[model samples]
Target: MERAGFWSRLWALLLDGLMITIPLNLIWFMYQGEWTNNITQGWAWDIVYAAYMTILPVIWNGYVIGKRVLTIQIRKEGDQPVGLLQMFIREIIGKLFLGIATFGIASIISAFMIAFREDKRAIHDKLARTYVKNRI
Candidate 1:
């Protein structure tokens, strides 16, 4: 498997944002009986989004919506597919909490790391012992 480049990872993330938000907003509308930017209103939305990120790959053989669309996948250094604990570490602990603790600086640096590093791993991937690579 070849490592995914920065641009593919970046585009997958943008697609993932749309893949997550639209359904979340629709569910918010269903539950709240209205649509008023509810997906951005609270921490619950964040948890839901994080859950979406954390859970899907484990169940889908390293495919969440955007990664599937982009033909990339998350896997360990040994090329094994990620599991739930790894995904939780990668998404919740590594990305969200660490990003918050560092005031987004870690995330900014992670982007650069992905762009420049030969392995294309960000902080979260390193934390989870994971990497993104081309599907083929």
Candidate 2:
């Protein structure tokens, strides 16, 4: 399979974020009957949402709904199935840093670097020893 391009991978990420966010927000609102404006609560929700986003692909062989739709799957550097520990580290550490930038500036820069790197890896991908590839 061909390596997935940066734009394609980015689109998949955005799609995944939306897929996770909409439902999570809906559930949060349903439970609370209004949008919760508390920063602490928001942060708590972020933690929950992050876990939801991270755990699924890690456990499911890297084919989250967005990735499945985009015909992309994440694998280890050698194209093997990504291990749980690697996924945990990637999600908790790498993704958390990407999220800290809010508008994905960090992710964009990382993607650009990945595009030129010998290994074809984004920052998160590098840190986790993972790569997103087109599904055959």
Candidate 3:
């Protein structure tokens, strides 16, 4: 299987942020009649979106909504399906916490790794022992 490109993966994530996260946050704002303190996170919809990202691929054969749209998939090494704990490590621990803890340096390194690595695996992918593959 071919690896997904960095640009495609970046675009897919942007699409998810725009198409899903933003809209859901907007709906929550409308219902609450007030903006959230953070606006982008620390809200119910953010948690829901995080859960969606972390959980959907495990059960949905590696495709989240944006990944599905972009024809890419997250999989473990050897092209096996990802699992719950691995997804949790990838999305929550490796990406979120480490990204935050490192002052975004890890995120920048991940971008480079995804762009430069032959397998297109990011730091989070390495941490979780997973990678994104191009389905097209």
Off by over 4 Å in 2: 35-41, 98-106
The segments of candidate 3 whose C-alpha lies over 4 angstroms from its true place after superposition are: 34-38, 43-46
- Cα lDDT of model 1 by residue, 1-136, tens digit: 5899899998998999888788877887898888766575579878878998999999999988889999999997799989999999999999999999999999999999999998899999999999999986
lDDT value for candidate 3?
Answer: 0.87
How high is each candidate's TM-score?
Answer: 0.92, 0.78, 0.88
How close is each model in CA RMSD to the real structure?
1.4, 3.4, 2.1
In angstroms, the error of model 3 at 109 is 0.2
Order of the predicted models by TM-score, top scorer first: 1, 3, 2
Q: Which lDDT tens digits does candidate 2 get at residues 76-116? A: 87779877777776777677766585567766677787677
Alpha-carbon lDDT, every model: 0.90, 0.75, 0.87
Taking all chains together, the TM-score of candidate 1 against the true structure is 0.92
Query: How many times do residue backbones clash in model 2?
Result: 0
